[model samples]
Target: MSMLSVLTSFAKRDFALAYRQRAELMQPLMFFVMVITLFPLAIGPSPEILQRVSGAVVWVAAILSLLLGMERMFRDDFMDGTLEQYTLSTTPLYAIVLVKVAVHWVVHIVPLLVLSPLLALFLNMSLPMYVALIATLLLGTPVISLIGAIGVALTVGLQRSGVLVALLLIPLFIPLLIFATSAIDSASLQLPYGFQLGIMAALALFTLAAAPAAIAYSLRVSQN
Candidate 1:
């Protein structure tokens, strides 16, 4: 089969398996909603304050929500020998790794993306802020998965690597979080947010180019 076919099949398989574990798949989305919902109660429902902090709230919640599932990104595949089989296959490991990250992103991030508008509503975000927020998320969340995949791959075999993965990833995720929230903040002021958006796009592209090889290598080293 061609590489495209292999990637598509692998993504579908992973997605199907993730769907079978419906409760686990729901955790990140639930966390994302709860955090967004609870923020106003904790901070009080002042529209002015909500508008000012909305971007930061969404971006922070997104990072934490994605982290909730990072541990599972490669653990099942590694534990069941699926990862070993892929590593040994003639297919390029980078393509396989990319597909795996993409699957995880879709499974974990899509629900959050769908619910973001409601969160925006809860935060009383302006239309422009909402637009920029969605734009950043569209460009940012996959980058999180792509970069987080490397950390997850590195620790997949460990007894308890969840916190370790978070530590390894939070620093790597800072630039993205900054760019994303900055874009939304700019939008709130009727300013052009394209610069921040462009930077985020560039970061996403860079991660796409670099992360698959890194993840593949990390997986190999971790399995050693």
Candidate 2:
């Protein structure tokens, strides 16, 4: 079978998991909405305040939402003994994980991108800034999702794994968070955000190349 065919089947498994646990998929979406709604209450109703904080808030929410949903990418399969089966399958385990990670990004991160504009309004962001934020998210979030999958896969079957996962991920996530929020901040100043997007897009590409083999190796070692 072609790599595309194997990837499709693995991605379908992700979709099936999404279908079965509808609420799990909803958690990140709900978290985003709830977090955006709370900003006004906590910080008062100033447009300036909202504008000042919105970029960081959006990235923060994006990161947390990804964190919340990451475990589902592999932990359920690990629990059901399917992860081992995947390791033993004819297709390369890393290739299988690569597809699942991509699907996981679609499940968790894409909705965050779709909903970013709505959240941006609560921050009192202007149309230009809102557009920039959305653009940065489109270019940047795949890195977060892919890197977070590595953290998730590392601790997939461990008890009380939350703290460790965050620890593992924070170093990787910092660069993305910084540059993404910087892009939105640049938009606020009416500066060119294109440079930041370039940096973010590069970061995404780098993680795409590196994370799968790292995760595949981790899972294989865990099984030993």
The TM-score leader among the candidates is 1
Q: Show pairs that collide, candidate 2.
A: none
| Candidate 2 lDDT over residue span 99-122, tens digit each | 888888787777777777677777
Per-prediction TM-score, please?
0.98, 0.95
Model 1 ranges off by over 4 Å: none
Candidate 2 runs further than 4 Å off: none
* Worst 10-residue lDDT window, candidate 2: 109-118
Cα lDDT tens digits for candidate 1, 1-224? 67788788888899789989989988888998999999999999899999999999999999998999889988988889998899899888989988888888888878887888888999999999999998999999989999999999989889899999999999999999888988998999999989998999999999999999999999999989
Q: How accurate locally, in lDDT, is each candidate?
A: 0.90, 0.83
Candidate 2 residue-wise lDDT at 204? 82
